[model samples]
Target: MTPPLALYIHLPWCRRKCPYCDFNSYPAPAAIPEARYLAALFADLDADCAFLINHRPLSPLQSIFIGGGTPNLFSPAAIAQLLNGIRQRLPCSAAIEITLEMNPGASVMAQLPAYLAAGVTRLSFGGQSFSIRSLKQLGRIHRPRHVLAAVRAAQAAGCRQINVDLMYGLPLQTLAAARADVERLLDLSPSHVSYYQLTLEPNTPFAQSPPPLPAADVSADMGEQGQQLLAAAGLQRYEISAYSRKEAQCRHNLNYWTFGDYLGIGAGAHGKLSTVSGGQVARVIRLAKWPQPTAYLAAHQSGHSQIAHQRELSAADLTLEFALNALRLTAGVDVTLFQQRTGLAAEHLSAARAGAQAAGLLDGGAAGRLVATARGLECLNDLLQHFDLS
Candidate 1:
């Protein structure tokens, strides 16, 4: 089978770190050298191309995602240059989904048209909540009105696909408030919706000084209610935290969930590639770039650009990997997906399955694909721990 390839570019700088976010993003100070950053990104892509040449031929890039500190902060020219660099080194499909993440703020909102002109086919708005009080509590700069304006701007710019992100379980957020947020989000009529519960990640302000989130039962009720709201609006939950209209799901993210290959180029980017040793058994290799922006740039300037902190994925590791991602989807993957993606028997994890099924975590039988039974998805971390890499 041919290997599937995609490109991921990371922008490590953010205007400010959201109190609840623990992503590998840092606050951007004044006077960022925009030109230098673009040049570094281009050089980073160039280095990745050299590595791809050693393994398999470059397939047309099926997807390209320019993700945050905030990709919209960069000028259209800078973004264009980055895309040009990818095109020069790798071939791309005619309908390649090129997505850029933008904050629902004034400055980035103005750049929507220019980004569309630069070949951005999709725009995803980071509209965390519609509640003005919740927005202030989360340290978000944009108001509910700003989010509406941003969506309109992207639509007016002729963007074919638009995704709106919503957050739940905020401090002081009641079940009523969460439902209101969902109602407001559906009112915008976005092609895609991503609703995620707030988690206080380590090193984040909310983690250090924990907020009083809704209780477990309350959070579950809020999630179920929001899902029902989305369904009524003609959107279906494809994966945990992600919902979409017919044919509106983000292919770029689906690539990640299906265990496809992608080249991650940018600070703190991560990728998984399938390695076949010329007609022998194939192994899946995981690659990660250095996280720090300054350090990564320095490494790129020096000669060795890619810095993979980890590489190997054993048979047991691959089984766990496939189960962990595939099971997250509402429509569980086919039983054959295990052997196809992991090159292992589908029954490899049968022992774990029996335990999970007996405990009301997974379904039963051959056609019974593994999934987080309602209770399992809520305590996903605990379910995932059953197949620990260690």
Candidate 2:
């Protein structure tokens, strides 16, 4: 059977870049070329779909995610045009979950109804923190009041599945402050919550001139407390940084964590696809579009290839990549999924699995699943080292 497929549409323009964000995002110009960009996006998607159809059977798209610097910055008419074009080109599942990432700084309230009408079923708000001090430190443009207003607007728009992205372990963040942020988010009764620990990524401004971060122990305590608070509010921790109500998990991201196939379109988007070659051999291919918006559009207009990079994964590469994603899930994936996704036999992982289990990093349950122990989840880097195919 062909693996489930998803679509990721990246919007690389944000009002301003955050100090800690290392994503391929840039500040928008005075005017966004929405029409031309939408045309380029469909052209990029066409190329990817052609490649997939030639290599393997095309599965109905299970989900579509519109994410980026701030997709909410675009007008709803643009979003509607994009979504309509997507449906016209691809065979989308009847029950596909479509998500659009929004930021409070943008006037999301005015666009929520149009977005819903355009087939967006989920709204993910980028509300990093409720504390004004932390928001300023992070260079976020939105105030706490904006976050509240956006959530209220989404709720009033009859959006049932809402996700608020919150960050802990900010510069000079205290446990009390972190808990307060979680408490404020819980009050909104969002269907999903992404509580992330702030990390200084390489090449980011924060990495070059680091802020005064909390101590390691303090950060850990804040995470534990926040998780406890979320659990108390009936949100289950399904993945490392994600919590959701029952059946409310982000399907697009879940597909990613499970090593399912997805086609990525837009500037700096990355994609992974699996195909069976030579009758019995399975090959996994990685593709990435041009990183710059101007370059991507130029390539699209010229009918030139938008993919800046493409490579087929070796057996070892597939094994390591599969483990890298699957182990991030709290419940983990079935042992058979390793083979189904990677085309590698379970025996290929026996030695590493045994070593990890012996080291108390993996659970040795008889349920035919590969699960990480609490210790493994805490020391995830150490556990992943055991599966290093290199």
Which candidate number would show the highest lDDT if scored against the true structure?
2
Candidate 2 lDDT (Cα, 0 to 1): 0.92
Position 388, candidate 1: lDDT: 55
Candidate 2 residue lDDT tens string, 1-390: 467899999999999999999999999989988988998999999899899988777678999999998898789999999999998889999999999999996567887899999999999999999999999999999999999999999999999999999999999999999999999999999999999899999999999999999999999999999989999999999888999999999999999999999999999999998886654337889999999999999998898999999999987888788888999899999998898888889999998899989999999874688899988888999889889978
Candidate 1 lDDT for residue 387? 54
Cα TM-score of candidate 1: 0.94
- Per-model RMSD to reference: 1.9, 1.3
Where is model 1 poorest over a 10-residue stretch in terms of lDDT? Answer: 273-282
